[model samples]
Target: MFTYDTTRATAEAFAVAAPIDAPVSRGRRRIRELCADCVRIVLADLLLVLYRLRTVGLENIPTEGGALVIHNHVSVVDWLFVFVACPRVPRFVMHYRDYDRPGFRWLFDAFGVIPIAPKKEDPELLARADRAIDEALAAGDLVVICPEGTMTPDGELSPFREGATRIARRCNVPVVPVVLVGLWGSIFSRKNGSPLSSLPRAGRAQVSIVAGPPVAPGRVSTAYLVEMVTLLRGRHR
Candidate 1:
């Protein structure tokens, strides 16, 4: 087991960083209260039926705050591990393009996922998303993001877009880097010319999630973020 205390730490990895101070929510919530709770229950049941999530270092996740969680984008269900690691309720910054898919749309809307236009050239969309992030942080909620922008075509890692640092700086919130490993080899792992229907009849996965220390804003850098991401990725190797 690995232990981490990241709720308090100075930022040093980047040339531009700031202190994020999103407060923790004072109210109470249950995962069932989100948009489509019955579906979330179904997802939980599916996790048991199809995937055996071997989660570790959950304690590394900060329990409370306006924290920005940057994670690797692998499978479509990355949020599942986060829901298990983060507090009962966590918000995701998802892509607008995914909102229309029936199966995924149900889940996304049910969880109150905030959507961002997939087109990076859309300044208005970006601005809207930035404000939504600020509002969510100000309300003391956890925001889960995949800095790589989209799901990887292959399981290999991709470049993390620069938006994470911006969100951290804009909200002055600590960025927690999370790595989801082993899922690519699990039931939902992608295959050549195979669609979702081709997934195994039943499968088990060795899923793991490790959170790095919460990094302060203002002093964050691209290298530091990569280093943190690399550290999280190391757990699976």
Candidate 2:
């Protein structure tokens, strides 16, 4: 193991050899992120056409600063719609099993998806996910979480877990509530109790994404979020 002096000396040597200009690095990173966003939007356009998607109150998603975006989980493609709708590229907090899937791991890693499991499954994994979320929020990054923990089996909304409220309070960030309408009977939903076995709708599904104003951290709660989302969802499934 290296001592403090040795580590400092090594760092100094590297810095001297290749001094990094902070402003230039930041500018380059911003440009790269913008380019990536452009690519994401282009890909999302295809889905938009396929789904005949519409969005409402999208301005509620902050362009800057950290916040928790909590939404109901009704289908497998819910995250994709949220990902495409947000102005800022948000980091998704997804299930560890999904993140660790054999073929899709590369895609999740490329987008920096945060994989989380229950403490009962693995305490260390849960701890790491919590830390990653905190760090991301501290860095003013948007973090999206599906508080239902899993997709609803039926077309109705499921009771939300307390994780979203807890994170919002701890990080002192607002909670942005979003609702996905018209995904309940889609192929991605658990309509037949299995997404894989379900078939796509006959025509392009008219999907709507409704976003509400950010709720203050002090007022955040599992019930309140569920209510807000339900109201936004209206009579739609």
Candidate 3:
């Protein structure tokens, strides 16, 4: 394992401040390191310091109640914006590899990461993920899923994965479609299976986050979901 963090990489690492999902009254005691709210506030500040970005349609995120947010994956730190834009408290089930990493342990617990295996459809991993989704839904929390399996090296949306569909159907929740553009164009964009290097300076990267109304669970075919998201994502491209 490397002894330090890679510079100009798109990987994510941060702590949360407040609990957008659950709040504790003044008369009650709080759990250890439960600082999601603080994390959000800090993250907002950190993002501004790290890169220049433009977010649109964030208001579409429901101001209240549970929501399942689906977005195209680009930069690894893109999740920071998801938390910032979301109105309600948020939690996301992430790629299992992220949670399994040693240094990423803080990110998993600090930001409430849910383990999800994509490259390998391990039954055990699926079972754990299913349980986590159920608990999140039961807690009336917003669910953030990439549904694209993994981050795209070429800075484009990947084919939508089916696991998110299965979870949304099982939980009977509405799916919010979102389009993320420009996070990867920054120094954060990772190497495409080659020596790590930053793209030529583009005078700060441009990014857009568009949150559309939620799509309720249905019997729609996978092709339909793919087309719907692709078209919506194209709106800003």
* Winning model by TM-score: 2
Tell me the tens digit of each residue's lDDT in model 2 across 82-160.
Answer: 8878886787999989888898765565455788999899898888788888877887889999988988988877888
Which lDDT value does model 1 have at 19?
16
State which candidate has the highest lDDT: 2
Which digits, one per residue and each the tens of the lDDT, describe model 3 over residues 33-143?
A: 235544555676766655565666677776656667888877667787777667655778877667678876675555556777744567777776777677777656688
Candidate 1's displacement at residue 66, Å, is 0.3
Please give the distance, in angstroms, between residue 156's alpha carbon in candidate 1 and its true position after superposition. 2.2
Residue-level lDDT tens digits of model 1 in 1-237: 212233322232112211122222332123223322333454556666555566655666667878888888777678776764564367788777765576666555445577787454666776666777788777777888888886766777788778888888878888887888876644344643333535454446556677777788876665788888887787665
Candidate 2 at 179: error in angstroms? 0.4
Residue pairs with colliding backbones in model 2 are: none
Query: 1 or 2: which has the higher lDDT?
Result: 2
lDDT of each: 0.65, 0.76, 0.64
What stretches of model 3 exceed 4 Å from their correct place?
1-34, 118-121, 190-196, 199-202, 219-221
Ranking by lDDT: 2, 1, 3
Model 3: lDDT to the true structure: 0.64
TM-score to native of every candidate shown: 0.75, 0.84, 0.77
